[model samples]
Target: MKFTTATPTGAGPAAQFTGNVWFDVIVAGQEPSRVRVNTVRFAPGAHTFWHRHVLGQTLHVVAGVALVGTRDGVVFEAHPGETVVCPPGEEHWHGATPELFMQHLAIWETDGSDAPETTWLEEVTEEQYSAARTRSA
Candidate 1:
């Protein structure tokens, strides 16, 4: 049994994220494994742009509050210890609430091919963000 000591943190691309976000690769599975895991941290109000996974995605909130929104204007809320899932090819975005920093374990799979696993779309506009918060409130 081989154990990894630690995995380095990766900076989320600015083109795909707003504010500040960081990710640590917890697991990078290969061939037989087929699973990928990332421990992602977002500063208050920081969030990822609209995107969708080829094989779906799951998020387990580790601390603070998480806000996940879909293309249809539904912003699902999750507090610490809560988990959320986005079905395959369902465009969505996730991040920390405006008031608190947040961390979550993002679990997904590698399509195991050359094609990209995620397709990122436009950034969340201020109006859209505000509306979501208001609706959630």
Candidate 2:
């Protein structure tokens, strides 16, 4: 058995996210493995731009409330211990609620090709984020 080395926290780039966001890479698998995992933290009101994964993505919330928005104007409110899945090629964005800090484990897999695992689109507008949301039951 081997222990993995820890990586320093990285600030989510402005090109891909808005507000204050940070992440720690938990696993960036080697050649034989294509999985990737990260623990992401969002300050109040911080969130990622609209993006889609080639092989879909899963998010497991760890703290505060998380708001995940989709192209259909549906924002899903997820709390701690809740998990959300975004199917492959579905455009979506996720972040903390305006009043709270949030953190989640972002998990996805690469397609094993040279292509990027995720394609980022436009930033989520305030109107889109402020839309009414449905809480996860």
Candidate 3:
């Protein structure tokens, strides 16, 4: 029953994100636990670069609207209280819409080894970001 220490909010680096973004670590489990959780805030038009998790990732929208896109140009729209999952190794990107600020809890696990848990790729182009989105029911 140990309480986790508070961690400082961090700016999303330009190398991995576009526009303005910030994140606060919620849970970063130690050995024997691989779970990692963070509350991420994105400014309007902010988004992450193309990336994939080694063991998958989960996102729970907390405010505003979220737009998640895949390699196939399909963007899924998620609103507050909705949850979305990206299966292991499925390349994807997520962020706030152009007109709204957004916040979501980003959850994922670290592979038990030294390898990177997320592989970041190229930034999402404007065409990709502006592509039409399919609303989540």
lDDT value for model 3? 0.97
Which segments of model 3 are wrong by more than 4 Å?
none
The residue ranges of model 2 lying beyond 4 angstroms of the native Cα positions read: none
TM-score of 3: 0.98
How does model 2 score by TM-score?
0.98
The per-residue C-alpha lDDT of model 1 at residue 10 equals: 82
lDDT of 1 by residue, 1-137 (tens): 78886777888899999999999988888568979999999999999999999999999999988888887777878888888888999999999889999999999987888887888899998665655442232
Clashing pairs in 1: none
TM-score of each: 0.92, 0.98, 0.98
Write the number of the candidate with greater TM-score, choosing between 1 and 3. Answer: 3
lDDT of 3 at 32: 86
Candidate 1 wrongly placed segments (more than 4 Å) = 133-137
Q: Candidate 1 versus the native: TM-score?
A: 0.92
Tell me the tens digit of each residue's lDDT in model 2 across 1-137.
Answer: 67989999999999999999999999997879899999999999999999999999999999999999999999999999999999999999999999999999999999999999999999999999999999963
Q: List the residue pairs that clash in candidate 3.
A: none
